[model samples]
Target chain A: MSKAAIIPTQLSIRVPVLNWAVWPHDASVPEGPAHGFELQYIDAMTRRRLSNLTRMALHVAGVCVGKTPRVRTVFASRHGELHRTVDMLTSLAHAEPLSPTAFGLSVHNASAGIFSIARRDRSSATALAAGEDTFGYALLEAHVQLRSDPAAPVLVVYADEPLPQVYAARSCAGDRPHALAVLLSHEAVRDLTLTANRSTEAPSGGMQSLAFLPWLAQGESGSWTGHRHTWRWH
Target chain B: MSELKLQIKQLIVDALNLEDLRPEDIGDDQALFDDGLGLDSIDALELGVALRKKYLLKLDAGDASVRAAFRCVNTLAELVHARRTDSERTANE
Candidate 1:
């Protein structure tokens, strides 16, 4: 007997809290770059060790889960520290040794690893990168974790930085550095239903997480349609 | 403060990214590890690399003197001064 695959028709989640940080691309500021990241939540020495992408992720994650540890975490990024990887490659090409600190913190899951260390959290953490649908997959992973333990909340952080100039030709929607954190639980404050389907339409530009930011910021029920799926929050 | 001590202090601050700290703020004999400047192992490794690059000194990770030399800014300055003198003396020979 052949077994058929089962696809979930809908998924529900309750977001107890959410936080986001987005860099300003326009030349509104007179002097320094406008990253829009205060990051007062982290200490000075710890902050020094973080990259821009990790800093954004940790900032939002700290805000969403204040003084709360021992919760499962899912971090998603499309291009995780591409600039750092490029720098390492350039150094190799020149026969220069790589910086130990940079090499240690340049992985795709470095943000999640640093978050765990900073918070002293021992709970399970997962890092994901799935093309443009990374944010959706991360949320689904968080949902699975929430289902496993109803009492514990799962923190999902999505952060991405713009691709290096070498790969600028393939940039997508909202490619600027940004981070979003959502605290999900089984207790339903709001219901998010995700439906997957096939479509040939073009995907949204920049990071997929950007599309859900507006709906979350407004705190109103809405729907966002992606290239191959639709997310409804009500 | 001695010039070498001041230089080592500045190197520590810069290499470790010790924000809100200046060279003058660090005491010459103050402890740099836990209970003082609160630096950890990673900072130790980074400072060791910086010292090697700046002073052209060799550092042995397994050597006991390395930890003693890192005890304070005074000890670090003394280590750097000794290494420089040794290199100069060897060159003269």
Candidate 2:
């Protein structure tokens, strides 16, 4: 009624949600930003080096993987470990050597890799990024992985933060840094049936996962419009 | 000599993010790599940078002496102390 909504080709998908978790969950908490959420499973040496985003990601991931014996994970974040990458970049610009430890953990999938190490999980983890549809794509990836994966459940972890001040000149839609993990298994009840439609609209700046979380929790059904695809959960 | 060993232990703990460990927890003769501290190759690389920053200690990765020097906290301390005294002697000359 407001505008002419284009009808696009849609792909139907059915995936079950076994469990879910999020981090920095309390928005009303009056404390400063903290990444020191302790986990008994992770050693001090390993936990100390992680960024807040990675910590949040790991926290939600550990929660979702609660009692599951093993899982193959797909980690998605638009700006993965951006702060660490920025630090390493600054060192390079100043002609200083990058810290070997930082260099090792600066990858996009470092959180997934650390998850594997912490759990001592030999299961494979896939890390990916797609501008606005990272979470949506992760779901797609997980669905495919579940078909071939002999594992019980596939864990999908998504987290993102606002751009660092150093890169303030570049604009990003403001997003509260939060991490979400969803466990999907074929045996579980399929709560939401996903339908992805190809669209020509520009990407909705904010994270799709953030939009999907509330819809998944509260609404009977909802749809997310991205640059290339529109995903509906009902 | 013991003070230097303690100093080296502290450096290792701080540099490697081994916050769970204290300098006193590390024995002088404990192996640094697989057996005792359980450090791996990446840790050795990180320690090399820290050693250079603190004591100007630079050892070739390919050198046999470098491996021997890093065998334990005691060996690392000896190497760092030797490097410092040698640099000081050159500075005085």
Against the native chain B, each candidate's TM-score is 0.87, 0.87
lDDT for each residue of candidate 2 in A1-234, tens digit (9 for 90 to 100)? 433355446678778888878776664454366654546678766786777888888888988789787899999998888888998898789765677988988899899999999999988799999987788889889988887763568999998887789877764655678788888997675455788887666666666777777754554687778767888787
Query: Residue-wise lDDT of candidate 1 within B6-88, one digit each (tens)?
Result: 88888988878787899999999899999998988888888887787677777788889977999999999888877754454
User: What are the lDDT scores of the predictions, listed in order?
Assistant: 0.74, 0.80
Instruction: Indicate the TM-score of model 1.
Output: 0.76
Interface RMSD of each: 1.9, 1.7
DockQ of 2: 0.49
Q: Report how far residue B48 has shifted in candidate 2, in Å.
A: 0.5
Score every model by TM-score.
0.76, 0.78
Q: Could you give candidate 1's per-residue lDDT for residues A48-154 as a string of tens digits?
A: 87787887787778777766657789998988888889988986897655666778889988988877877778889999987777887888788788878879888
Model 2, chain B only, scores a TM-score of: 0.87
Task: Label model 2 with its docking quality class.
Answer: acceptable
